[model samples]
Target: MSQISVVFHSGYGHTKKVAQSIAQGATAQLIEIDNDGEISEQDWETLNQSDAIIFGSPTYMGGPSWQFKKFTDATSKIWYNRGWQDKLFGGFSVSASLNGDKQVTLILLQTLASQHGGLWVSLGQLPSSSTAATRNDYNSLGGSVGVLVQVPSDADADAIPSGDLKTAEAYGKRMLDIVNRFKK
Candidate 1:
């Protein structure tokens, strides 16, 4: 089986919950960037050995968390040697506002993967028509590049919307499928 890794940081439990769902659906390994914006040597090695990488972070100030940015900076060596060249890449993000500029966060991830010479994977899920969509509908927030999850500012992480979790899981599975197909 192709090995995949989900590298991410969660400021609150909400992002962590979504990441867990993604990992479960992908059957992928997890390498979390710590609060101090550092990853272990083992995490680095794991990322280097992965067949695919799915990035994730909570959107902060219209961008990815600083911790995830730190991890990206740490990947410069891998980028230099083309260690991740042509590998499949995907990303996901969560935020408090309905329009939290979450797209910016995904763009950052896509850029990082591109700099590594990785092949980008779109979410591959059709968005619900806003006219007909419900709050719990898949891709309700209409993200095509990556999964976007919105958790109310005051809501507990455990109370995240089911649709968002489902979207994340589906994105994970799609990423895995793309990785396996290209591995042939």
Candidate 2:
């Protein structure tokens, strides 16, 4: 099995819920970026040894949370050494609005992976965009670059749509499958 790690920063617990779903499907280790945006040296070691890495963060304002950005900035040393090079990389983001600029966050993650010379895995799932389609359907948000989720401002993390959670899990599995293929 491929060694996968999910590195994420969750504010208000919403992003953490999504990360859990993804980790559950990938059987990946979860590395949380704490409130200070600091991770232990062990987390860095785990990332260096993993076959795949998936990034997760909440979309605050128009992009990823400041904590996530801080964590990414701290990865400059790893980027210089190309520590994550050639690994399978994927990402997901959560926002409060359907069009809350979550794509910007995903793109930032993709760029981070690219900077480290890693290969990216797309969501590869079509949108559930039909009269018969509902929020409970998988990939209802129609994400191609990575998984995208929307949680209403008044809602708690538990209220995250089922389809979005399922999509996150499936994306995790997809990354694992791709890593297995590529590593072989």
lDDT of 1 by residue, 21-92 (tens): 899889999888889989888888888889999999999999999888888888888889989998889999
- For model 2, where is the 10-residue window of minimal lDDT? 175-184
TM-scores for the candidates: 0.96, 0.98
Candidate maximizing lDDT = 2
lDDT of 2 at 101: 95
Residue 164 lDDT in candidate 2: 96
**lDDT tens digits by residue: candidate 2, 29-121:** 999999999999999999999999999999998888999999999999989987888888999999999979999999999999999999899
The collision pairs in model 2 are none
Number of clashes recorded per candidate? 0, 0
